[model samples]
Target: MPGREIINLQVGQAGNQVGESFWNALLLEHGLDQSGAYVGTNPLQTARLDVYFTEVAHTNSQSKYVPRSIQVDLEAGVCNRLKSGPLGKLFRPDTYVTGNSGAGNNWAKGFYTEGAELVDALMDATRLQTENADTLQGFQVIHSLGGGTGSGLGSLMLSKLREEYPDRMLATFSVLPSPKVSETVVEPYNAMLSIHQLLDSCDLTVCIDNEALYNITTGMLKIKQPGFSDLNGLISKVMCGVSTSLRFPGQLNGDLRKFCTNLIPFPRLHFLMPSYAPFHDARTQAWQGTSIPELTAALFDRKNLLVACDPRFGRYLTATAIFRGKIASREAEYAVHDLQKRNSHNFVEWIPDNISVSLVSVPPVGQKQAAIALANSTSIQEVFQRSLEGFSAMFKRRAFLHWYTEEGMDVMEFSEAESNTKDLIAEYQQYQEASADVDYEEEQEEQEEEGQAFEEEQQLI
Candidate 1:
């Protein structure tokens, strides 16, 4: 069978930038250049580039491969850069869709007015790309929640995709606003609004925190001054790591559907916490050890986690670890078992074997061994709580209310988003405090019933 094709939708400025990094990484892994010419000799590795690339047969034996993705932005600047960049020829001309004006840091304008106007054109581009796929599996959208176009327009795009292709897996790589950082004053409002919509429409949303990225780059990567490119590089690697099973053959191969089924027990609780391991300073990577246990431990470390939340406070319902490189399966299994044994309290007791391991033989372009982890941990609610606090603070004074209101947004929308966010946080709290050991409670009820029967027998005697 042909590979399950995944159509990527990179929305807005941040999305396009991250998308550029992701495609560039893929080019290196598959032994292809910026122009999409397959130059690598590792037939085992480049065999399944079809998962994300479409082939163009030429008169000669050589063929060109173009990515099966579309780039969408409200303004023309970001998309233009991708088109003129080194990898310009790798994407089809129609995949770059942009609007004439910007969203002006207003979520309402992106969702209701400017974004709605451009949605038809972008969806048309998406439809054209999907037609070229043999078995289109689903869509993965990458965008940031702190800005207008990425937050508002990205939310709109997800809802539209859900309406049309309800069966396909709709996953998102959402760069959520950080509690410590404030890019725009209305970021909290925009993020909450996006969360409210995503709770209903998206199948899975991987929450990426900027605060965590800043911490990782400064602390682990040892970068003095981290730019957006530095942060996006990490996100792109995690993106590739998680999809390794889908793109390349693994010991326990899984498609998007299996991945979702394994991690997500309930539909409403699908926001995943992502972490990539084996983070070493570029200068010291050659000296760092790539032991299986070390890589697994790093994945669980809060410092390595992409979200700025403590897993110690929240329980992990389930987690999937994707390990890459030529590692022994037995070693991977023992490493996971030992990690779980040591930190059993952090995982939900109700779920047996919460941690699963998948091994991919093909390593990334640089490293010998690496791993990426996705956990359905309840601690991720902290992200929502931070946004809620910020949103409530601004909403109390009606800060910048006129901008959204003038875009035909109702006053009740704010209230609804606020309420929805609270309920979500409450739900996470409820599960975190839930207990599974019912032996004592059940024994007490049974003894009470037995005593009642004995009294009736005594009366008969």
Candidate 2:
């Protein structure tokens, strides 16, 4: 049978920038260079590169590989820059979808106007990529949940994907803006609206927080003043970790569908937090002689996490540790034992085997060993809480309402979005409460029975 094929759809400036880094990482992992030529001949490194690219015959009797990826943006500058970059040859020129004018950070304009105008074209490109695949798995969208084109247009595409390909799985790697420092004042509005759509349509949504990325870049990577490029590089590493099984053969979670099935029990609780250990690059020398126990321990550290949240406080519905690079099966078992002993309090009482382990021998380029931890925990509730607070602060004063209202969006839409967000928050809270060892419902029933017994005794007396 043909392997699973995933079409990547990157929207907006943030999406495209991150996508570029992701492609670079993928190429490096597969031992390929910018020109699609093999740099290393390691037989052990067996990643199914054909899943994301198609080989075409060049005039010089050589084959050129182009990615099964679509790049969409409202502005032309970012897309143009990507085309001129080192990895430009990897993408098809026709896959660049741009609009005449930008959304100006207005979600309404991006969704109602630009999104509608470009939907047909976007679908056309998607269809072409899907047709090329032997066994089409689904799409993986990279976008920011707090930007106009990334949020609004991305939401539109997600809804359309569900309608068009109901059987195929849809996942998103959604970037969230930092609450402390954000570029757009109306980001909460964009985030809320996009989240509403994602909750309705997507199978899974992996959240990457900007504040967490900033922290990782500065503290972990040791970058003095980190830019988007630095953050994108780190984000790409997390994506690679998540995608390692899909690319290479593994004992567990060998594809996107399996990965989702393992992590997500409830549809609404699909927001995942990822953490990768032993952060290194070309300039930074790889740390030598690290034990599996130490590496596994680092995966649970808050400083290593890609999202700024405390999973220890909230319950973890599901968790998986994906170990790449020189890790033995025996070592993996010991690591899992240690992890379970240390984190028994982190799991839900209902789930018997909530934690899973997947080991792959294919190490990340220039690293001895690396591990990624993916957790579906109620800790993500804080992220939504921040978004709700921000949205409420502006909505209470009716700030920036005209921007959306003038773009043919009804004022009631805002209320509906807020209602959906509140519902989502409630669902997470319920999950957190359910994960506790004490059953509040059972306790309440016992208390009621005791009161009834006391009343009967008093009557008899």
Alpha-carbon local distance difference test for all models: 0.91, 0.86
Q: CA RMSD for every model?
A: 3.4, 5.0
Instruction: Tell me each candidate's TM-score.
Output: 0.95, 0.92
Weakest ten-residue segment in model 1 by summed lDDT = 434-443
Q: How many angstroms is residue 391 displaced in model 2 relative to the true structure, after the best TM-score fit?
A: 0.5
Clashing pairs in 1: none
Whole-model lDDT for model 2 versus the true structure? 0.86
Segments of candidate 1 deviating more than 4 angstroms: 439-461
The TM-score leader among the candidates is: 1
lDDT of 2 by residue, 46-88 (tens): 3477777776777888666677899999889899998898877
